[model samples]
Target: MKKPAVLLAVLSFIILSGFTPQTGIKPCYLSLKKAGDLKAGTADRLLADADKTRMLVTEAGEVPITVTEGYRIIYNNKKKAPFVNLIVELSKPENYEQDKKNVLANLSYLNAQTTGMETTGKLLELDYNGYKAYGLSRAGISEGETLGTFVIFPGDNMIIYIYFNNIEPAKGHFKNAAEYQGYRNDFIGQYTAHLAKCK
Candidate 1:
């Protein structure tokens, strides 16, 4: 497979892993009741609103159980309240080394990708998922790491990481960064579970 295709596959699996069995589909996300329940139109509408953009979800693609692929929705679903996720696929790192490297690069890229980027504090290094992890927090968000992080896998081919946090201006986007963190927490937890299954 081509590199882009592989990356797309990786992205899809990681997103889909968050859903539970009762979710109707194999990997459907639970809706936020407060958000007036999750409607198909909601995801579409959120994608349309740039000003209300505290989160985003785009389609990745999946072939289902046999081997999912194509285009599917990946976004930060806050309507269901806390714990949003990517669109689909839901795969995690089986190879620890590569996962770490790929993940770190993604986080670093986000600093460059997002608008008005300001990085504060030191880049923290630790260990998680059997790989050395490094977390970089933007300066203004209190004491904890609040921007993005990367998990370096064993080699250099694959790296697993997630980028999130409040970073919102208290009033707009997400209610606060902590709310964003809830989505991050969900993404990581489901991804970790997927990794266990892959192993």
Candidate 2:
């Protein structure tokens, strides 16, 4: 289908639904970007080729899901150390808050995957972009630091996962809990504002 037609259908669905963001402003619907426009890594050296970024839109667990559009940003010139990756995945789900327990469990699985790290603080919960989310902080037992923020955007039917970790094994350090929280707030705020402008 053409972009405009898909967009029209999406917008109609959202506007007609009773769900609304916390601000009570409904976002004009649009894809994150056409796949061709995405560029990863520094201009000097390419890390991820835009043409290779592929996510199939399909049904999962009886929910009709489609990955309308999305993008990925990879930091550190593709090196695994001190890694950071920001990904935006916009999808349309059959129902809001569907299989919420399973969703949370998936996030918990990621938390368990971290190795050689000690919990630095309690799990941080948030009401981000009209959705319930949480974050976790951990420090390396003998090397690096890490912070992971998981956001489930119910209104938008999107899940944004941010993982920030120190690349330097011996020199890595995670700032205070407040600093991580600030980062989360800023990201969610900017994304919500941008969505409001979509059309």
Residues 86-149 of candidate 1 have per-residue lDDT tens digits of 2322223243343333444445555555443345333455543554545554433443334545
- Model 2 has an lDDT value of 0.45
In candidate 2, what are the lDDT values of residues 19-73, reduced to their tens digit? Answer: 7634311323222321112223431222333332232222232223234445455
10 residues in a row with least lDDT, candidate 2: 30-39
Off by over 4 Å in 1: 1-73, 80-122, 139-146, 154-156, 165-186
Stretches > 4 Å off in candidate 2: 1-69, 74-84, 112-123, 128-131, 139-146, 169-185, 192-199
Cα TM-score of candidate 1: 0.33
What local lDDT score does residue 189 receive in model 1, on the 0 to 100 scale? 49
Best by lDDT, which number? 2
Superposition TM-score, candidate 2 onto the true structure: 0.44
